[model samples]
Target: MLSKSISSLAKRVSSGLTPLRSNPEFWLAGTIPWLKTEQLGEKFIYSTTEKISKIALKKTSIKICRPNTLTIAMYGEGKTRGNVSIIKSEMATNQACCNIELDPELADFEYVYYFLKTQYNELRSLSSGVRKNLNSEDIKNFVIRLPQELKDQRKVAAVLSALDAKIDCNNRINAELEAMAKALYDYWFVQFEFPDANGKPYKSSGGKMVYNDMLGREIPQGWVVGALSDWIAKDKTGDWGKDMAEGNYTLSVDCIRGTDINGLNGKGAVAAPTRFILEKNKGKILAPFDLVIEISGGSPTQSTGRLALMTSESIKRFSRPVICSNFCKAISLKNSPYAFNFAYLWKSAYENKVLFGWEGKTSGIKNLLFEAFTTKYVVCMPSQHLAQGFFDFVCPIEDMKQKRLKENDELALLRDWLLPLLMNGQVTVA
Candidate 1:
């Protein structure tokens, strides 16, 4: 659905691609995380940690694309293909991506970035066939419309960039808050350094440790060993069959898929496709503190048990109800005190490959062995007071994370809404 104004503007503008030339700094695949999922749709990305060497760049047929360069993934699966990004630093990319070095005199880079974000689906459609890949030529000839007034373009970019910056700020805040909570979790539960009677670190201050046969180690005397099932009030994999074609279902809701759980404990503004389901099945609707785990679709390198925590504030981002996709299992905790703790536990298990033992293969895909997973996994059941203490200490931080997440959702919505309107000139900067 291309806007008439955008279509007209695209016709007027010329597009170009950086010429491929032999370079020594060629990444040669696997050298760096040359490709990314989070970087897509972002205004700027710097691969400081996953960067290619100058020698590799020199040996390969790669060009050092300049900053503010808008690029798109020329090939990949799902949303990976045709996704756009702006280079924050001079970087080299594989041929699978198309780099567009826009002329500043002709267009504002930020305005073009936002335009591409809105037209992503259409851009994606240019590629055809089973693999759905676009080539450099496809991007070279791709069109963009620029405002006659550079200030107008800047104004539009400014409005959208402000929203993006705010969202980025919130994400930074959430990352810091999550790190704080995780550090506390590791200190108290893993290191056994919980607060003691005098508000001192418990295990470090020698607060009553005892041997526990179940864990094969000494734990705080009062804690009991229990399975994850002990804390779960309800557990079930999600539904998928009820499509819009199904006469039973009416409105559609964004279905959270396995790929959507991007973070260790939760997702950050994952884009999910909508699916229709029966209103009665609203019971499957995700609630705050509900744990959504990926039960299927894992690769050898990636594990199956990816986890995400639904926040009370975050859940409201959807208009109707949000439900997990079939590949995920939603677990509602019996109590709120265990929410943050269990999220951390599951994350640790996934990261450490502890849960891989509870995985089975089906149709060439890795699946979480549900029954075995529930029965085999063990948890240290700390006293209710201790659990409550941890929750009380972290609750404010959690609340802050959710509020920021919710704000990001709103900001994204507003930015998206304004994009086409601004591009079509229905909304003006003045």
Candidate 2:
């Protein structure tokens, strides 16, 4: 049940103010508009790559919304699907944009955010336009059955917010873990800071250290770096490719993207079918313990060089002959001594330093050529034994992070289910 005071506030907002036509620049560009997308940050925004210019802002109308307000992306572009976000920042807008502002006193802001998120599909269905947009009238007329009291809204929002907070925390932790791993990899491999033959720094040795103009740093003693091709195996065929095409196999991106392979029980794990598959033209895919990488589309542009390990099950599933996509596939290794983790570390270093050339066409489809990655240079050989040792140390930490992600995913499912029900008064808060 909701408190009477909250219900009164809802009534005042619902019937008090008249909807007015306004320019977006007034909201997006003005002193402070209640609702704006920029506050959510790039991660949650659709097409984080797309930027809105100040000149473009001159065209749209901005609806005045309040702080902690709720707004929906009425546009139905592929990027706009399921795009429900809470406005934590202010903006001045121009004419041409349509947005609705909710009274925060009547509705809990977080609750409204979750409420709209749950109704995203419905909203999509109702939208109509060449670009699929929702008008302010449509939002004003949309019915949301809430408890009569504000207390109920708070209670409901609290529950969902807790779950979301946890998910956010988990994501942050995972990011930190990845950063830590990459830093350690760079320290030992690039800086060569590991203990030397006499427990001294590699840099202090009598070996020649010349300052490289490109890096503006001193080179290691007797150390020479080359391209990635020098280290990886050249072979591309295997039994694993066959199983993946037959729908009996899959791949995990956990090592690269930081997502986990769910529902795996034992040492023999199956790949999640979402991204991994064997292509007909490519024969005999990657095997177990094979190193694979995302060859395209990531930060630092050219070097979106993230790597992951192929599970044993993925290898068996694709055991049949088939070719993998150029964007993602196994790394060819000269020797089995180096584990996938070492390759992942090395790839990170290469990515950090390499300049990703402009690869996207004006057509909007960005293409990362495999040839570009193959030809791009990096150090090929380091002591294989040392690389393997690094992998052995980091594998446990990766496993733990994977488990936390899985748990957070399950909790998210629960929050999604509860949101709409509570908002619609189907589920009451005590």
Candidate 3:
């Protein structure tokens, strides 16, 4: 194996790829987009809405870095620095992002991407400055070891990329399935157009409607307006010790953060982080169809009271029971059917500000006024038969999403497991 300084091996390496500092005044807004530290870790970033137009690009020393270049975050806080990604297309970047366009004949860009990914901690350690910034020299002087043959580099990259491709494909499938489910929810509940007698669209077909004083709208006759407590069997805020206790390995509470909640649904959650615990608290253990609500942690733009449904796939992924942190509250529904219809209802509530209406902010942390919101906010309760039907229709879709998410988790595991082996020459491709 031979080692080479990244700068010596690469045809181009840049820390300040664009004039972000000197020309901040010219970067008001424009047609051409640029990336920030937040968008750097993904394999491909398609849009950076915060951008400067082509006209603005001409006014400053900024230039569009070409496609296939690797970009790294040189400065940021809390896992922002040292993260890497590839710009699959031509784009401009801010000062915090260092763009490296490699010489194809000398190195494979994908190979370099993976190599840099493995060196995130090392890169962070090399960072200097009051804020621990990774400068142009830091990136240039970095050393990488690899086989002399360029084919070998491509081979290693190909192996990793194949796994990534599979993971990406799985995520796409899950997103599509979720979208389909959401569309169905909107069509049925939001529109009040669920199938009526003789299988006709209810609202459009002139199904009887009565005004509900609480909801301030006309709902299907015989349906009731009720609070969330009607459907909730048991609910409690989670509990955790000062440190994660050690006995047997179990799931991590990180899986249920506020960011994981998108209205009533959760995304990008599969396996839990590895944490050891003495025993599972039976009350805290999560079951399929349960709801985990983010009761704390909020930003000015995003409030508390986000909800995520616990799926069967998640329950099966961990050997021990799944649990949330003190920041979250877990609620078990009276029946499984409520999981489908209620999730959408809660989503509507979130959008309409019903859930966040009672939030309280203190010390920069937002607390969900759970009892206040639950008691005051009303839900459109479908009849028993319609709720059952909605659950039957949406269950399969959620199942499909869960299956795809599980597959992605497995694929990611396979890729991470193989990365070091392939990087160290233990596993080779001809």
Off by over 4 Å in 2: 1-67, 75-77, 89-101, 198-201, 204-218, 234-291, 294-327, 335-366, 420-429
Best by lDDT: 3
Evaluate all candidate structures by whole-model CA lDDT and list the values in order: 0.75, 0.49, 0.76
What does candidate 2's lDDT look like per residue over 235-295, in tens digits? 4522222222246335421222211121231111233333344334333445555665544
Model 1 agreement with the true structure over 152-238: per-residue lDDT tens digits = 889988998999899888888889998998898889899988878888998888789898777789989888898888888887569
Q: Go through the candidates in order and give the clash count of each.
A: 16, 54, 2
Sort the candidates on lDDT, descending order: 3, 1, 2
Ranking by TM-score: 3, 1, 2
Quote the positional error of residue 411 for candidate 2 in Å: 1.8
Error of 3 at 192 (Å): 2.0
Between candidates 2 and 3, the one scoring higher on TM-score is 3
